[model samples]
Target: MGDCVIEPEQDYKGRVGDDPPPYIKMPQNIWPKDAPFLREGLYNYYSHVFPLAMKLVRIFALAFGLEEAALDGIFKFPITGMRALHYPPMPKEECGTIGLGAHTDFSWLTMVLQDSVPALEILNKHGQWVQAAPKPNSFVCNVGQYLERQTNGRFVATVHRVRNQTGERRYSLPFFLTPDPDANIHALDSFIAAGERPQYEPFNVGDLYIRRVLPARHRHPTSVKYRDVPESEWKYELLYG
Candidate 1:
């Protein structure tokens, strides 16, 4: 785990007592040179899924009542990060016990491929934890903060986590899609009514990734250094936990 963001003894930021979930994060820029089998498998998956992801992006643009290519420029080169997560059995614990802490994806979109294990759970509007059981040959897709902000909170990002209670190992692969680094993040004019104000501030995509996203997972907090970015420049309202 030398290169992993969080160590085995470490906990996810703000999650004091919970253990960091076991996972291998694969950035699109890196590949395992020695592990041909694993590398090839992931490459195959990426090749097939990337085109489909673009189609989904276009669909989302159309859904937002914008031109089909409205979002094409920003997502021309997306930050596609994948995670291979493993949750071991803990049958003695209650089903609702957290395998992964509650959190929302701050990226653009996420598609999760799960094994035949009922571990993933999502928080519903009624404030209840609903099981996201695995369906054969299907994926669970959800929007993220980026889209929510772009749409001025029209598309809500789902809050989700994992809970292992089946006395069996649970595995999942989540592919995260984020905008290109230089893209600007702001609410579209179409999303706001006349005389209404936009709810979010404009910020560069890369700046947020470096300042907010990286620091939370850094092995040494000081490893991620940033200039004096004003608090207002990056802070945004989170409607859910």
Candidate 2:
């Protein structure tokens, strides 16, 4: 397994929107690494969902008061992934425990297809924790860190967390769409004002991804060769209100 596992370089830093280094990699969790069935099924699902994501991106661009195509280029051949999550009912002893801690998504955007179970909650702009009720045939959408930076902080990524206590299993599918491998992410000029500064720093998509995912603790033995990403910068670094 180590042969295929690439390690990050010594100069790794967790900057949003930066290109990733050659050592960075995403994990594959499909059963039987050699089997193509699960891989193809997921790919086909992404194929059907990617276009919808693009359409939403177009909508997002316009909503941010920029041209429809303003953010479209960044997604060209972007890093995208979809996964099914299952959370079992929390035992009575663990009633107050959190199933998933509070955090923000690292992708440019996230679309969540949730079942009837309602456990996810988001911190709204007014500092209120709003329970995200599952709507039939609806997907909950949220802005991510990259989009927040690109918009000069106009669209703040919603902080969220989930917990299960209803004695029923909860399922959700979230699709994360990030920038292309070589795409550079800096605040768009259109969103900045004259003689004003951009709220974010420039970065490559791949590098930022590596920084966000490389765990701060419980790391693999091979990862010791690389620089460590600061615990303060992890996407879930902030405390839940």
Q: Pick the candidate with the highest TM-score.
A: 1
User: What pairs collide in candidate 1?
Assistant: none
Query: What would the per-residue lDDT of candidate 2 be over residues 1-241, giving only the tens digit for each residue?
Result: 1111111211112323444434345433325678767656655666567679889989888876789988776765466767778898767787646788999988888888899988889998898878899999888997899888878887888799986656577888888877765678888777898999987899877667656555442464423534354544433111110
Off by over 4 Å in 1: 1-34, 91-96, 220-241
Report the C-alpha lDDT of model 1 over 1-241, residue by residue, as the tens digit: 1122232211222323432222323211345688867766775776566567779999988988899998887864455667778887766656557789989997889888999989889999999989999999998998888888888988889999887777687888888888866578889888999999988888788667656654475564333332244544542111000
* Predicted structure 2: clash tally: 12
RMSD of 1: 10.7
Per-candidate TM vs. native? 0.78, 0.74
Poorest lDDT segment (10 consecutive residues) of candidate 2: 1-10
Error of 1 at 161 (Å): 1.1
